[model samples]
Target: MKPEIAVLDIQGQYRIHTEFYRSDTPQNTIILVNGSMSTTASFAQTVKNLHPHLNVVLYDQPYAGQSKPHNRHQTPLTQELEADVLLELIEHFDVQYVLSFSWGGTAALTALASSPRRIEKAVISSFSPLINVPMRNYLERGRRCLADCNRTQVGNLVNDTLGKHLPSLFKRFNYRHVSTLAEHEYAQMHFHINQVLSGDPQCYLKATQRIEIPVLFINGEWDEYTAANDARQFAYAIRDSQFVSVENTGHFLDMEHKQASHISKIALLDFLKPPAPVITRPAQRLSVAL
Candidate 1:
């Protein structure tokens, strides 16, 4: 069945454009959050892979995709507000699992912290708990390119930072979407980077300590923005989380080569499976008189 598009009012302040793929007998619901400068389309393959067994939810963040455009002069966006928006969607769908990529992972972490029990499990891929030096440098360059309205530079930055990781066949596809991003979307992406960098560096680290649900961190072995070591450290901080590295892949594992994508899908499917219900022996009847 075709996905249905809908709008959700967030605290009456913003409207999020959401897409839902329903299943007759879904094992669980998976909400896929997009990365910076990306839309729900980013998860086309992922949705196709999981729709048969899992109900999928996709949405555009504020100033992204079909959502309202952002104003450059508006107050800086906060992860807290982003978390609230995400939590609203989770509550709306009664979703148990969340799958977030790249920038969206920050929001997912924040949401998990805000409502520790709302999510049962999460798969965070190509994301870091905190911005590392290399990521910081890349974002700084992107900010300059966007500030100058240098589309060429912006395109190059996107290629070097994100596209370089994709397989040859998928490079063109990745570039096409990056090229079509609106100026407002670029601005919003930059704003998100700034918010994450400026906020508590240990925010996600601290959140990991409080989160009770299981989380899985999937990073490409060659991911430039989020190093394998960093991903491992982030996963280690969480009480019940595991880290997986997709061999010979980069940041965009979901859209990487076929083999990489397949591996990622399998990992996600295995992780999303609900845990077995705990059973205990029935209480024994009281003995006579004991």
Candidate 2:
């Protein structure tokens, strides 16, 4: 089904571009939150798996994808801001579940930590709440490349580091996408890197501990950007959560060139499916009338 387009106004902050894929027999709603360098288009494969089961909402954050900034003056966007946007979208669409990838998971968790109006469950992939030393160093290099205004270097840096573990096709695709980013996108990238650099692990732990809903956290076995160990640690903090580490996969699990993507997609579909209805047979009775 063709998704209906909508724009969400976050008061005076910024406007978001949203696409709603309404299920034919909708039971509930789920929101797809994009990563730092990712757009709503990144969730194409994901949406396909979910469209049949639940109403899906896809959106781009400000200065990313189709979403534009509010003014010419460049204001650094924060995870807090992204979290607020998620909350507003939740209220607007009456979303009951969240499925976020990469940095988008941070914002989604932040929103949940703040005590959202309503959320039943959440699933996060390729995300780690805390940025450890090695991860911070890797992110710092990207920040430096962005500071130098060398989009090519920025793309190469990721490929040389995290993308090296990804499948060949996905690596080439990522390089091409990043190297060709528009000028405005660099500004957005800078903000995202800064957000990661400035993130406090302690706060993230607190946030993870505070989440009340059931969660499913998935990470690639070979993922260096958001290591499986970190993802597992955070998942353990939640009262009700499960962690799955996909073998032979890297940061980009669902986009892999091999069966890994299919494996991850199947796991996602299984998790997001609504509970099956119980069919109780009724008692038989004899008719009194002849």
Candidate 3:
């Protein structure tokens, strides 16, 4: 299938945008979700490499990208609400498999635990049981960066972590800020992060324990965002799951390694070979919706 951008109506708002790409062979459909403050662009290139076997869909999480905003007058998107958004995407795309990154991984797992029968297969990355991991360091850094309105440090932090000594690439990873976002948008990004970190480990532990699906855990050997230890711990919680750490790779595994036939693909290929279990429903935002 060819690549096309499509928007799905959810709860009367079409603010959330999805980039839909189908595989010529249609091996499977994977509904991909971006992380906090990130957009669908994160998974753009991966769709191309996966086009041979997967109809990949990448979408903005509500209130993060060009998607819906969280109104102070209304409710913020909880794990429940986010899970509902996942369900809407699945039904719209006829998705049977899910691929999520960082923050989105927790939400994806929450959906699995809530609606065990709906998720057939999943792959989560740079994501873990945040409750178990000490999120204070990440939260503090992110908070200070936002408070100071320091996109430069925020940008440099990511580049430095992933690129290590390479200084040139920091701006590239900060596409959402350095390029796409405005000053006001940066503030919104911070606010979103605050909401996520405020609840911390306690909020997500319950969500993490609820996952009961075939899950694949992946991390970059140098993933500063989601540590290898965190990924391994997360994989351990899900029964019959595999954890893989890409060598010489940073947080941006799909991008840095898109061209090379890396070991990550081996894990992915092996996972897809097994038949997915039959699903029944979902953990939608509307908790009772399922």
lDDT (0 to 1) per candidate: 0.81, 0.82, 0.66
TM-scores of the models, in the order given: 0.88, 0.90, 0.78
Cα distance off (Å), candidate 1, residue 62: 2.3
Residue-wise C-alpha lDDT for candidate 1, range 1-290, written one tens digit per residue: 79888888888777888999999988888899888778888898889878878999999887777775532225545667888889999999889999998888878888887654557899888988657788889988988776666767777787777678766666676667666777766776667767666788787788777777888999999887887678777655688888889998988886878888889988988888866789999988987763
By TM-score, the better pick of 1 and 2 is: 2
Decreasing TM-score order of the candidates: 2, 1, 3
Candidate 2 stretches with Cα past 4 Å from truth are: 69-73, 167-169, 284-290
Name the better of 2 and 3 by lDDT. 2
- In order of lDDT, best first, we have 2, 1, 3
Give the poorly placed runs of model 3, Cα more than 4 Å off.
Answer: 64-76, 130-135, 162-180, 183-188, 200-203, 257-261, 274-290
Candidate with the larger TM-score of 2 and 3: 2
